[model samples]
Target: MRGPLVVLLCCMVALGACRREAPQTGPVDPSGDGQVTISGDDLVIADLNWTPPPVRIEEGAEGDARARAAEALGDDDLHATPASAIPLYLALSAISGEERAAAAGLRRARIRLLALGTMALDEADTGDSIAGLRAAHEFAAVARFLAADDPDVLTYLQRVDESDRLWELNRAAERALDAGELGEDGGGALAGFRQAAALRPGQPRAMQGLAAVESALIRRAEVAGSEGDFQTAARWLAHAAEVRPGMQTVVDARQRIQRMRATRIQRLRDEGVAALPKINGVAQARQRLAEILTIAEPGDPVARDLRQRIDRAVHYGDFRPGQVFTDALEGGARGPQMVVLPHGGFMMGALPGDADAEDNERPRHAVRFERGFAMGVREITVGEFRRFVETTGYQSRAVRRGFSMAYDERTGNFLRRSNVDWRSDYAGAPAADTLPVLHVSARDAQAYADWLSAQSGRRYRLPSEAEFEYAFRNGTSERYPWGEGTPPQGSGNMTGALDRSPSGRRWGNAFAGYGDGHWGPAPVGSFRPNPWGVHDLEGNVSEWMGDCWHATYRRAPADGSAWINPGCRDQVIRGGSWASSPAQTRASWRALAQVDTTNARIGFRVVRDL
Candidate 1:
């Protein structure tokens, strides 16, 4: 080290002319010796021994030297170089007065040497020993040239020692392997890992290297088995087996691989079947149906029928297709329908304090619809209604009368109004074609129903209040079609205050505060559909029922059918309109309007026999 230090000092003095001005005072004295000494212009080489020589730069060679240094630093793959190359370059640069070049060379050389040394220790390969020794000598020489105060030089010296220690560990691992203390797979992997660990033992990656080697060997064996090289595969497997004895999982895996090679398809099929749970009867049928549906072509009759059967079963609480009921109703918007109601009976009526609950909804009578029926899934869309009107020249009550009831906030009531028609109101709106016809009166709904019946040659009409309720209730006798709770906002575009209002006289002001105080009707079904798949059952508009609005339930029919009153002029509207409040939307809630009365908030979904 002292010999290298003297050499470095000589080089620094020789390269003094090309050396840049030192950024700080003479070398820092960590020993606090209070001695001021100078070896060359702005260069103080101190404390020789283990230290290496400084990188030197001769006059006029500064530019070329810096360029060479940059080039060396840029070689990312220099790790393949022998570590000795790094220190050798540093010593040469010092002698040649090319300090910058020497620094770059040394940096690359050190990194590569460290990597090599670490790898050598891990693999226990003596191939890197010569290079490692050379790199150590070179580093020591450069350390001597660096100012005694330069922490960088001291750090490099410490790194050299650490590299040596790793090398020693690698040597010990090699010795162990040679002594038969470790098997080929395990010993070889361990030797490599131990070397990496010695260099950076605290890093988890050091252990990962060992694992990676094991994985590679395993994969090679698997590949051999896949290629029909059974013997080679067995040999690889045997190596692994020797390394990890008593590992039943590995043994089983090897056996399985052999079996797969013997009977690939059968083995796969057996495994697949074994993985499936034992299913029976209805479950098996359901599973088959699901599989068929997944791969079935769209519009396939069989698939469609199967899907409908499934829906019917789910609705009626019966897995048997024949068990579900079906009746014919002239197709309204949706073609040919069936009525399917839940089997259970429900206590239909106003609870303790239902605001809009009338005497008719009292006694909370137990009423039941024996079967679930599939009614028209959707209300007649504008396009369908338009076709009916065009084909029959049937003028809707709203259009014929040229006016409809709209809630007027200023008047605190619904008033006769005209500016908007269904076509105009929903013009340019997306999905308008599928939206239920709005701004139609009870008369219009009836006419459309009549027209549909006539065209289809089947009976079609507004559902009786009971039928409507049954359909709306779906199966659950909850407050709403969905369940027994207030629906979230936007479930339907009804007046917010109406939905928020409690049932009673206090709630009567809903019409006045319609639109949540904004006052206007929103498009039909601009909210969540009921569980039964019916939309706008409540909120968007009050739907006209076939029955007349009665003052009480004195003689109301228990059957799920309409109780029509021939003498009545005012048609009954169930399911409160957008202008009405939540109380008005209750199952027992009712409203009355002249048969010819048309309103923006009044629209209806038709019912058919099925």
Candidate 2:
């Protein structure tokens, strides 16, 4: 008896009672075969520390019962044949008064009970658990009656306790998982499962529980990312990875964050544009762009375009129409005083039924200023040009060519004169610094504008022809800059009938009974400014425009952009000078001259982007 029991216990130990197997369900045998089997949940725990129930051997059955039980237990498949062996083991425990025989029965029943109940997790198998429990209860009572202190008996008791712990862990894990206690929040299904796996690693129940928790976390991450909450998405994915590192689902979920950026940025842009045109529109739009750049990839065209529009909006918001300002230059000097113009639309050619209308002013069309810019409040002054020339030592076209068109006062006509430059006024004489600079080529004006740009870190350029006309009209489509009939007292310094030259010569065709104080160009801003708060736009020297000469208003730009081809020799000139006749001062008048042409009647002002 000891030999078979010893061999069985050795096998159980070597197989490691702590090692868990994947579930392999074997069918239960319902037939008890008249054996006294244990019945309810009560017996599972009640009999673990059993006491003896007065082992009085039956009077004449000890020898025969012992022989039959030993015969049943001798079979190698005794654990599976619990229906046959459990009854025999019980019979022997009762028939024989020997504690050794009872111990043998307890050992057989323990192995048999585990074989039946280890995987018998179904509640429907009350009969199987009862049979194992019944055998253990009866046999363990008698077996421990005298052998309670025996090493083998004590060892068997310890194994039964371990089995109970494993069962409890699995049940707790299952319940926690069903209750949505996934471990991202801590102290949930993951804790129970980890303990169970540590006790019996790679067990099916614990591994499945861990997988469930991981899957739930990944789903949460996906939901957050879809709604553009990438921060939350990243947090959840990180938690999922921590829960189970190297999980493919978490890795795939993390990749989706980058893919969602396109939709997110476009939505923000739409919101920003919609909010624009309000009082705080630019501020709101700027905030939206900041968020966009955080997620947008470098060089994204949509992001770049949004930034540019916002910058333009900022300029629009920062200034008001008719506002005056000046930029600081490098040496503490200031650029020309400038006045801001309002954005507007206007008819761009001659008015109907006006006698001064030329063919070039026909074919009227609409022109619009979508954004406002700052224009010089007055024509470029002689003092300003002297600073540029003295600073850069630049050679004007008149200086290089040694001659330019000037007022030949003796003949009462303009003619080429040597030594005439920007310093000389209309009469070919050195003039006061306050006078509008003259004898400057269009190229020279451009150079001065370039120098101002570099000094002030701003863009300074000649006005486009459309811009000049827009300022000339100042939002009114009048026949003349000052509107029809004889000129007002000091409307502009055009040729007048009462005007007298220094040599006592008077105009043959001029405004009747109208005379400015001096015959030649008046000092800049000497006359009242137009409605736009800009002086000398049409009355000072005619200003150089940035466009090349186009014979008519045909195919002109409606957006107020310069309609110029680079290197075109004949550049446009606009407005009226002191020598201009009444017809020349009409709002629709335009003319062109060679790029290198320099004359006393042509000077320039500048316009800068806001």
The weakest ten consecutive residues by lDDT in model 2 span 28-37
Predicted candidate 1 versus true structure: per-residue lDDT over 549-599, tens digit per residue = 777666677766677877779877888665666677766677778887765
- Measured by TM-score, the strongest candidate is 2
If scored against the real structure, what TM-score would every candidate get?
Answer: 0.41, 0.51
**Model 2: per-residue Cα lDDT over 339-457, one tens digit each:** 98888889988888877788887678899888888899999999999999999999999999899899888887789999999999987899789999999999999999999999999
TM-score of 1: 0.41
Residue pairs with colliding backbones in model 2 are: 38-130
